[model samples]
Target: MTQRTDVVVIGGGQAGLAAGYHLRRLGIEHVILDAQTAPGGAWQHTWDSLHLFSPAQYSSLPGRLMPAQPGQTHPDARHVVEYLAEYEKRYELPVQRGVWVDAVHRDGTCLRVASDSGEWQARAVIGATGTWTRPFIPAVPGRREFSGRQLHTVQYKSPAEFAGLRVIVVGGGNSGAQIAADLASVAELTWVTRRPPRYLADDIDGRALFDAATARRQALDAGHGDTGGVASLGDIVAVPPVRSARDAGLLPAKPMFTRLTSTAVEWADGTLAEADAVVWCTGFRPALAHFASLRLRGTRGHIATVGTRTVDDPRIHLLGYGDWTGPASATLIGVGRPARDAAREIASLLSG
Candidate 1:
């Protein structure tokens, strides 16, 4: 038997929870289907050393603020997981754990969400499955011949295992920097980037970046020219650990290499450097494979979205994919506004 609902939120992560919050506020019937056996979403899969770039105050969902721990400046992955678990419990959100959504397609006036557990016929669907599962590693020449340990950031756990070895950390993003910093204490680390790493001012954190992005978005929406001085979240925030690493002269990065040798990496200048391992922190792609059957993907394999609603399928909405779906929707605080807007839209559509 197919269960029917007003909405079906895929992936019970931060974005999904936020969407559920708004849907509940509007008295809308909805169910969240989570692939994980428990709560926490991607936070449960993060590296042991990972910590939020923002403080607890700035890293919160729509209704409740993440609780702050005394003397703890930033929340760690475990802390975030605990908070997410508690948030779901507090709201009494209807979440079906371990229900993996396989595909979603239009079924007459409703959408059919097929999952391992069951199927849901919903008036609207929200895809909040964020990018953690789809880690992106750029192809490099001779990569297949490399004998040394090669892993993406998704598989990284602790630096302790890499002790006394030569490690190469690839990519210039915050993950690359943070992982490289973590490895420096136990290993000889080399940071590689396609371009020079951009570091934001030490005083700036995720809060400031979010505010700046919000202001920039508001200005553009109001028909004003881009007030381009605001810094983006892409620029690394000098968090305490990262700051310490920088002060200790361990945060320097080298230009990207041309190819990978069996036991070493060759630079653009044909210089070879041997390494025991290569950690690729190359970021992620949206986990939208479940929607592939819908054939709604536009340029760059991204679903065309105007505000959270899919341009190709008005009944489907995307949340927390990134800026392409909505401004800063990938972050904790950023997902709320879009979720709210999407829920309101869904409610309006269903009511009509």
Candidate 2:
């Protein structure tokens, strides 16, 4: 028997939860299908030392604020996991755990969401599956011949694993900087980036970045050009640990190497740096493989979205995939507004 629902949210992460919150407020019936057995979404998969670049007050969902811990400025991965679990319980959101969605296709006027557990025929489908699973590693020449350990940011757990060894951290983003800082304390670390790393002012944090992004988005929406230069949330924020690393003169980043040798990396200038492990913090791509059958994906593998709704399919909305869906929508605080609007749109569609 095919289960029927007014809406089927294809992820129980922050975005999905936010959508559910708004849907419930509007008296709409929906179910959130989560692939994970537990709560926390992608945060559960992050490294132990990972902390939010924003403080607790700035990193919250709609209708409820995340409680700030005493003496803790930024929330860690475990704290986020706990908060997400509590948030789900507080709202009594209808989330089905361990239900991995395989594909979503059009069935008559409704959307058919096929999963490992069962199929759901929903009037609308929200793709809130974030980019944790699709880690991106740039191809480098002679990468296959590298004899040392190679791991992406998704697989990184602790710097203790690379302690006392020569490690090379790749990418110029926040993850690369943070991981490089963490490993610098106990390991011989080399930071590599395609271009020079950009660091925001010491006083700046994730909250400022979010505010800047919001302003830029609002300006663009109002038919005005963004004339100011604002640092994105992806830029390094110089958190306490990062600052400490910088003060110690250990945060120097080198240009990307040309190729990988068995136990060394060859630079553009033909300099060889021996390394025991290489950590690629190159970031992630949207996890939209389940929607491949819909044939809505563009050349970049991302569906064309017009403010969260698919350009081709109005009933299909994407959340938390990044700026294309909505500005800063990938963050906790950013997902709320878009989710609210998406829920309202879905409600109107169902009613009509």
Candidate 3:
């Protein structure tokens, strides 16, 4: 027999948990299904040596603040995962761990969701899975033929692991810069960006840059955008962008790479760089393929919609998509707004 619920959440991350909490507050019943043995999806898969660029004050899930001293940096991967685990216990959220959802289909008034554990029939379904379900590694020609250790930035942890080795760090985004910088001291590092990245220092002291970026990202996503790139708010304000890093000879400012041969990377300008390992920080993609019926509005992976409502299906919603450019958009702040709205929408459908 298929168990039933008012709604079924596809993920158990911050988005899913927040949605579930809101549903409960409205007296709506829902179940959270997650594949991981525990909560914190990205954090569970993230490398050991990582910290949120955003500070503790800004990274709270929803109701609880990330416990920390005022100036302490935001929690690391371990701290995040532990905090999420504690969050589950605190609210008694009805989450089924280790239940990987395989497919979802509409069944009359309710949606049928099949998972590893069993099946669920729900009046509505929230795709709170977030955007990082799939890693977006670019297709470099002859990549398969390369014999060296090719790894995605998602699995990377520390620079010590690649110490004394020649490594090619691909992509110009935050991950690429941070990783390349960290590895430079220990390894022979070469940084390659498709284009120059606009780096912003958060505060004058440079200690709170992550928080600043998160704030900007949040604003942009909320549609109340600000001057793009980066802004430093407190402490030391206005530090140079990463272009200065290039000028200072801390990194190489090579043009975009043409292609990757089995043993070397060909630059756009007729140059070959040898590498023992290539760290592709190409970014992430949304795994919307699982829901075959949810149509995307445009060529972009984004599902075009009016506000938080999906254009294809009002019952489905996406949050934390890169669309929000303000500080809270990318970070955990203000996510509660969309999740709460989504939960209310689902409850309304169920009540009707």
Candidate 4:
């Protein structure tokens, strides 16, 4: 028998769950397919110490608030996962987890989505799989020759794992800074950036400016043309200079790494930096390869879309994609408005 629905939601994370919630509210028939055994997607596997920079209010979804007191920091990955599990049970959201979708294809006017269990046909599909699906590591010369272990920030869990190891963190983004700062006391840490960082002060208060900026970044990634303009990597905010760590000599400024072979890092000025380990805070890419039919490509093979619409196939939607506007797109606080907006768009298409 061919199972049919008005829409098929891929990924049971924040975006997909929100989309399912709205669809149910509108009385639209849909089924959520998640690869993981539970909700919360990548959060289920994130680092143990990871916490959101945004406070509670900004982290809330459209219909409910994340449990927290005023002025408290955003929940950590474990809390987030538990919260999503609660959200699912609270609303009785119909999400079928532990079933990985193998492929999705357009079948006539409907979409044919396949999972390990079976296939589903729907009038529309929502790609709520977040941007963290693929970690973006740049190709530096000699990377293959380096004998040390190299890992992306996504694979990183705790600094304790690297205690007493000489580590070089590449990229000056918040991830790099946080990782460097966290490991400074436990390990030999060297922070390397290609250029000076554009740092922003941490917002202790959950104000509109902070929340709105996050929402805007999410919108940009969702294919919504709502941002002002683009700027260089240096324009993205970084952590304030770690004067204390610096003064303690725990955080040393290392030269920009120009090449990475199998065993060593060649600095821009021709010095060799040895490392027992390397954490590439390079960034992430979209998880759109599964939708090869979309034919959307940009510089470096990036997808070109604003909020939900893939630039090539407006009929298709992308959720939780990052850098749609700039660096802010990847944050949880920023993804809410876009998720809601994309939900509305998805709803409209399904109804039509």
- Predicted structure with the largest lDDT when compared to the true one: 2
Overall lDDT per candidate, in order of appearance: 0.89, 0.90, 0.70, 0.70
Residues 165-233, model 2: lDDT tens digits: 999999888899899999998999999988888878888876787677778878877889873425543
RMSD of 4: 3.9
Candidate 1, 117-226: lDDT as tens digits: 98999999999999998999888998999999999999999998999998999988789888988998899899998888887888887777767777777888889988
TM-scores for all candidates?
A: 0.97, 0.97, 0.84, 0.85
The pairs that clash in candidate 2 are: none
Clash count for each candidate, listed in order shown = 0, 0, 25, 23
lDDT, model 3, position 143: 84
lDDT by residue (tens digit), candidate 3, 1-352? 7999888888888777877778888988889998778777678777665566656666677777777634445467788788788888898999998888888887886778988788999877777676666778877777887777888888788877899988999877667776776677678888888766545444323224444555565676678957443433321122233334455677764656878878788876768888889998888876556576544546865567554557777666665554331123335655666677777777776777
Which parts of model 3 have CA positions greater than 4 angstroms off? 69-71, 204-249, 294-302, 324-330
lDDT score for residue 237 of model 1: 73
Q: How many backbone clashes does candidate 3 have?
A: 25
Query: What C-alpha lDDT, on a 0 to 100 scale, does residue 300 get in candidate 1?
Result: 65
Model 4 lDDT per residue over 1-352, tens place: 6799888888888877877777777787888888888677788877666666556666766577788744444556777787788888787888998877777787888888877889899887878777676899887877777899999989999988899998899877667766777788888777887776544444332244444555556676688977543232233332233434544766555668788756667876778767899999888776666576645667678777755676665556777665462233345554565666666777777667
* Global lDDT of model 4: 0.70
Say which prediction, candidate 1 or candidate 4, comes out ahead on lDDT.
Answer: 1
Query: Model 3 RMSD to the real structure?
Result: 4.5
